[model samples]
Target chain A: MSDTKRPLSPHLQVYSWSLEMALSIFHRATGVALGGGALLITWWIIAIATGPDAYDQFRTVMSSITGKVFLFAFTFSLMLHMCNGIRHLFWDMGKGFDLGDSRRSSKMVLFFSVFLTALSWVIGYGMILEV
Target chain B: MSLRSPLGKVRGLGSAKNGTHHWWMQKVSAVALVPLTIWFVSSIVQMTRADYEVVINWMNSPIVAVLMLLFVTTGIYHLKLGLQVIIEDYIHSEGSKVFLQMLVTFSCVAVGTTAGFSILKIAL
Candidate 1:
């Protein structure tokens, strides 16, 4: 059906960068990243089911520096996706379609993503360090 | 030369049949995850310092087990849908798109089943 040499839509390079565009792209990017994160969770669950030895081995890796960094990134990605997802949900409801409202909401998404990511990490590290 | 009715010609094609299902499910799963994601994250954080026994026991709880199952199942379903959309958007090659889509669909099922089974094993 697409075999016709019809003119294609404008490509990314054609448009100037904007906050909403960035958020739109970031939503997909983080979504792909979280797909990988799902594997990590799957591994963790499998490890736990396999027994204590497997669980400890999994813990060793997760507690390592590299693991910590990935975990941190995963947390941020999750928060960002979750926040932007809510925006998309609002869009689905046919609200927040105004240009100004969309831009304003984009900023709120970024802010909350960062804030929630930080809050979770602080709580996470505090608990880890205490024990 | 076409004898078929206009509606009949378009029937069973494109979004004519269950076309919005994919789009709708993505939104539905997203809404479910709003609360599930928050709850799961907070629960994981609380157990950051927990030992294997503590974690296992937590998973064994009926409530925790049920939620964990829902989280994994819905999450993988959402992932599958999102990744399929991305693939369809960027991967223009028909063969490559189909291959990737199949890969993603199979992977999601495998991951979901594995995670679900593990949860049940511990809880039961």
Candidate 2:
């Protein structure tokens, strides 16, 4: 490998962001995040197998504020990816091909993911209502 | 493979043959993951307030264990396929692409094995 940098493609400044673009990018981004999230699942299972003490330690880490934040992020990513995956399935079936419809679906995914994530947390914490 | 030369056939290879299979499996696995993911997230959300024993007891169920093992396997497989596409597209270095591909495959196997084993151990 030679120590030389080749010319880069026109990117950062050339492309403007749109909902379609954002959804496409976030689909991949969240997909990547969810990949890393698998390790956390793995860790939890391993802790269970080890014994009660290890499981409690796992719970402690998971119950921390930082862990809660990360968990929320993971849940949000999962929801986003899921919504987009459904959109892709529709696309596969030759639906939602138009720009207007695609954008609409993208907006729907955004709103639905946020709503579902919030609802999940509400249920998890047993918070029926909060002002 | 269709209408290939005798030598090409003899070499047991030619242009990419399994692209369709790869694409199909990704789609199938993606579909499989939808319900599995819903089940998984709901379970985790419920476990947030449950004690360790409760969580273990939940995992100890035959239905839960088998489904979870299926979910982890399918999810990890899907994850590897998605990342492989991204890596193949963006990573310019041939060496890096091959290395990342191997790493992803290895990690998927290791993760699936450990997670499956643990779930089985607890359930059985």
Candidate 3:
């Protein structure tokens, strides 16, 4: 039996992706991820307000190795979202629409996001070790 | 001179007018989030080893509490509007777009109010 359904155009596997496309996809993906992380932050705040037992449970989970990994990812996502978000704000203002500017800003976002993420982790680790 | 109607005079308005205010608000909130997010991250880092009372005390400060509320509320509002535009542009289905937009708005309000009320309860 022959299939009647038509194949979709421009599937991910078919096209060679560019840095701009990769960054754009990652920007949305990270945004959704960080939105979930925001909920986790809200839960932590609520737990702190509840009692010691609640706070302890939250702290226990968040302090785990897995939690640290996730938090690191969250930090990176946060930074990427922040940097890309600024790029978006510039676009909204009708700036940075030129081809060179777009590519330059995209590269800047990628570089700064990594730098900020590393900086955050260093500062976070220092605080943890000191305290 | 009288061939055309007066309604044509005021017809075709200038801008769409809807996006201007929302765009302005989003920028305002984005600027606010700069300091707010930095302070938030610092506060969370400091609370790494803090106990329940310490956490409560920090949030209970009127200034901190107000800032937290502002941060959460404005952040959600900005996110909601941004996500709405993204959905409108990308989501082809009208019903799905409306549903998603409504969901985004409701979630923002719910999250913002819940977080604000919880903070207020602890602080006051």
Candidate 4:
């Protein structure tokens, strides 16, 4: 690569961080994280098909503390992505583009993501306890 | 104003007719996913204690199978489109950006196809 001077567009670093900016960045980050989680879904399916031993091993690993931590992270990322993805959908429909709407929607996405993730885990843990 | 040629009227740099399509599909998939993902998460939650046969039987149900397939396919498609925009905006190198886009597309198709086939086989 040659060292050449060229005009570059302003990026995130140039702007002071705000909730909207952070949400915009997190949206991409969560999208990539969710993509990795999608691959885990495929892995789960393959392990299931491979028989009891492999399935048990997979379960054991996934039930470990590290696995649980990763799962929680994945769950949070999924919730964040889903919430912001809906916000993006509204933007596509020509709504929620104003300054107030953008700010409010950004907060809503963050709030809902946390609430939904916690709710999902609570329900999940409740089921496990019942079993 | 000088007499302008017809080509001048049509010449401007924009999406070149492709802008709205990507935006629209992303929204369409997002809407579709609301119900699909809710069902998916709930099914998985319910299946927590399920054995292999139980899980397989659930997967074999026509409605579950169909919805899962739709979810996987549309999710991957939406992911590909979203990643393409991210890469285009962030990656300064045009060649690298294009390569990444192709890679994202290939991976999405590969993973989606594998999941689709596995779902079909289990259902069958």
Candidate 5:
């Protein structure tokens, strides 16, 4: 007789996931990942303040394979979070509520985040080449 | 012994009167971060190849320093708010939720203050 007693609806097995759903999960996941980036950036800035030796050690860690992977993931996460954030802003303005528009925007967010990540890395290496 | 009207209690329990302050500021910070992030990512990436003197010189630029300051300050604030919402939603224990809220604040303050000071030390 109670709504609370009813079996939970839309369990994972029951629901066919959508891009919007996946992106929603990624939004929060990336939020958490970027939190770690904050820590890394803080150490980096402090190292710069401490001068060359500290920064040299910092760069050593950054150039390591694990560090490279982390940096790549962190940058990708930042782009993804920013892209989804723009989608949310649009939602706030009372636009893109329709199913078709929501689907289109979610796909666009995925595309742009990946594109931006690749672009950043491309120019990033270009900077390295100039040195 | 209840003296309050039904409507008063109903309205009182909801809407802390701040209205959409959190929602609006999250968007504002998000908007600010778009350009800031672009500059920062590109700058830091470039600095990777440069020597310490060059890096310091880059940070020494007035425009670079100011943007870095804005980016870190607003970025951390936005992060704190976002984490609070996540923790509030997923952390079922009240104790953990409050603890996390404090953790987020303390870390952001430590990071933001240290970073801002670092930029200032270089720029000034």
Candidate 6:
């Protein structure tokens, strides 16, 4: 009885996905994730203010494998959000609204997000390890 | 032909009074955060290998302190605005929506204040 295939509203499942759509959703997801990252940073600041011992403890935890992984993900999320946020600002100004430009900008956002995250991590590790 | 005044007609259906202000602040903060975030990430990377005292010394600089204050303030403001929009979009229940929005606001304020205080405590 449930197998009847009458016309129904075009929900997310019914529609084909595009890069633009995925990036738009990702922008919001990254924004939400950044809130948690902000809290983590705030905790770091507080630890620093507490004392050397507290700061060392904080650094120890954050330098661990799991914490490093989370930090890397947070870096990528921030990069994506930052890149797409600029794209959004351009759109707000009535620029890059054309189909071609919009798609191109979305591709650029993804590319830069990955590129910047990698660059940042490389620089970060290079400084930390003096490599 | 309607007897109601304009205000009466749109009393419940009218736009929220601060919609434009909210939208404008979000955009303004987004613009400000672009440079601030870049500076922050670069600074953090530079300090990645520094010890606690060295990090504290960096924070003690006047320029660093001021920028950190600005970055945390603007970052928290943007986070609150963005989170509010997400909650409004996804949370259909009016009760939970209001609750979540208030929670986001309070948390952002608390985080911002704590960060600002720490920065001040170290920088000054």
Per DockQ, the best of the predicted structures is 1
Q: Which is the winner by DockQ between candidate 4 and candidate 6?
A: 6
Q: For candidate 5, lDDT tens digit of each residue in A1-131?
A: 36588676776667788888899999999998998998888788788888999989998999898988998999899999989988998898999989999999998999999988887777675534443
**Per-residue lDDT for B1-124 in model 4, tens only?**
5465656544532336454677678778889888887777777866655677787777778998898889888888878888888897889997898899889999999999998888887777
lDDT of 6 by residue, A1-131 (tens): 48868876777878799999999999999998999899988988898888899998988888999889888999999999999999999999999999999999999999999999988988988734456
Q: Residues B44-94, candidate 2, lDDT per residue (tens digit)?
A: 877786787898899999999999999999999999899999998899998
Candidate 3 lDDT, A8-94, residue by residue in tens = 576677879777888888977887786677677778768867878998999889899988888889888888888888888889889
Among all windows of 10 consecutive residues in model 3 chain A, the one with the lowest summed lDDT is: A122-131
The order of the candidates by lDDT, greatest first, is 1, 6, 2, 5, 4, 3
What are the per-residue Cα lDDT tens digits for candidate 2 across A1-131? 26659876777659888888888989999999998789999999999988999999988998899888888889899999999999999998899999899989999999999988988998787667542
Candidates 1 and 4, the one with greater TM-score: 1
The per-model lDDT (C-alpha) reads: 0.92, 0.89, 0.79, 0.81, 0.86, 0.90
TM-score to native of every candidate shown: 0.90, 0.88, 0.79, 0.84, 0.88, 0.89
**lDDT for position A9 in model 2:** 70
Point out where model 6 deviates above 4 Å. Answer: A1-9, A127-130, B1-13
What docking tier does model 1 reach?
high
Q: Please identify which of the two predictions, 1 or 4, would achieve the higher DockQ against the true structure.
A: 1
Candidate 3 docks with a DockQ of 0.32
Residue A31 of model 3 has an lDDT of 72
Q: Put down candidate 1 lDDT per residue, B34-88, tens digits, no spaces.
A: 9999999999988887899999999989999999999999999999999998998
Give fnat (model 4). Answer: 0.26
Candidate 5 displacement at residue B121 in angstroms? 1.4
Q: Say which prediction, candidate 3 or candidate 4, comes out ahead on DockQ.
A: 4
The DockQ-derived docking category for candidate 2 is medium
Q: Worst 10-residue stretch by lDDT in candidate 5 chain B? A: B10-19
- Model 1, range A41-95, lDDT digits (tens) per residue? 9999999999999999988998999999999999999999999999999999999
Model 2 spans with C-alpha error above 4 angstroms: A1-12, A127-131, B1-14
Between candidates 4 and 6, the one scoring higher on lDDT is 6
